[model samples]
Target: AQILQLLRDLVSERDTALILITHDLGVVAGMCERVNVMYAGMFMETGSADALFARPRHPYTLGLLQSVPRLDAGRRQELQPIPGAPRNMLSPPTECPFAPRCRFEVEESRQAVPPLEELESGHHVRCFNPVPAEEWQRTRVGAA
Candidate 1:
């Protein structure tokens, strides 16, 4: 925590740009203005942190957020983990890398790579089918 504070101070004092690469959403929320969600070593979603967190357009990004433990959640609340393990990078499939585990998988996503599409101003996602914010939240709650 001290180190993170120091880094934050340095950036502010020096008027410098900082690129933080981390899997911890808490850190991202605390320090980042923008965010890039990566899977299989490739970015699946890129957007402002607020936009991405409020309504993730990529299934992988949604899965990641849903899997985190929320402080406001009930004590007995169960974590909604992503259904399957990550794909092997050594033998990557030509199609959408997340298809094997994504619930919104479509035929095009399985047959060909999905290009990043801008769904909103400054929000982009590489997915053929994306779950709306409400549906994703519903699914996450239902799964738990």
Candidate 2:
């Protein structure tokens, strides 16, 4: 916590940029202004931290958020682990790396890689079948 505070202070005081790379979403939420979610060396999503947390468009991004345990969540709430093993880096697949584990996978997702498409201003996602806006909005409301 102290280190994070120091980093934050440096960014504010010096007016410099900091590139933080970690698997800790909590830290990302606290420290980052913008976030780029990656899978198998490819960027799955990129957007403002607040926007991404509130409404993750890509399946991998959603899975990552779901896998994190929330402080306000009930004791009985379980983390939804992303199903299936990670893709082999040695022999990367031509299709979307997250397709195998993604619950929202569609036929096109398996045939080719999806290009990063901007859904809203500054919010981009590399997915053929992104999570519906209504679905994410509902989840956000429920979580709140």
Candidate 3:
């Protein structure tokens, strides 16, 4: 933790770039201005940290966030774990890698990978069936 803080301090003081590759969302939230979520070596989503956290367009990204325990959530809040095992990275499929576990996956998801599409000024997601922003909040709370 001290090393991480020292790195952050050095980067800020010297105005240098820092590329941190981590799966820890807590670290990302604390240190990053931008975030890119990758699945099967392909970028599934990229955006500002605030934008991605506030509204995740890709099912994989949303599933990751929902699966984490949050202190802000009510005591009875349940974690929404992503179902199914991860894809085989040795020989990755040509189609969407997350399709097997994604609830919003469509026929196209299994047939071909979706191109990255911009949803807002700087937010982009690669998904054939992205969760609509209106549905994100509801779905996160198990309302959908």
Candidate 4:
């Protein structure tokens, strides 16, 4: 908390940007205005923090958000783990890196890598089949 406060103070005092890199989602949610979700050395998603958190279009991003424990949950909800192991970086696949673990992956996902494309004005995602807004809303309601 103290370290975060000091960093925030520094950002405010100097009017400078801080590029924080970490696996801690809580800290990212609290501190970042924009976020880039990476997997297998490639950017899977990039967007405003609020948009990414509220409606993660990429399967990996959705999985990551689902894996986090919701503090406001009324009861215990089991974290939905991504179903497979991480890709081997030494000899990565030519196809979509997340296909093996992604529930929404299609035949096209296994054929070639998906390019990062803008879904909204500022939100971009690398996916052949992005999650729908309705599904995201349902998940959010269930989590709450």
Candidate 3 per-residue lDDT, tens place, 75-124, comes to 99788799999988888588899999999989999999899999899999
Model 4, 31-121: lDDT tens per residue?
Answer: 9999999999999999999998899999888888887877777466677788989988898779999999989999999999999999999
How does each model score on TM-score?
0.90, 0.93, 0.89, 0.93
Ranked by TM-score, the better of candidates 3 and 4 is 4
lDDT of 2: 0.90
RMSD of candidate 2 to true structure, Å: 1.6
Instruction: Tell me the lDDT of candidate 4.
Output: 0.89
For 8-47, candidate 1 gives per-residue lDDT tens digits of: 9999999998999998988998899999999988789999
lDDT of 1 at 131: 74
The 0-to-1 C-alpha lDDT of every candidate, in the order given, reads 0.86, 0.90, 0.88, 0.89
* Backbone clashes in model 4, listed as residue pairs: none
In model 1, residue pairs whose N, Cα or C atoms come closer than 3 Å (at least 3 residues apart or on different chains), thus clashing, are none
| Model 1 vs truth, CA RMSD | 2.7
RMSD of each: 2.7, 1.6, 2.6, 1.6
Superposed by TM-score, candidate 1 places the C-alpha of residue 67 at a distance from the truth, in angstroms, of: 0.8
Q: In candidate 1, how many Å is residue 34 off?
A: 0.2
Q: Whose lDDT is higher: candidate 1's or candidate 4's? A: 4
- What's the true lDDT of residue 123 in model 2? 98
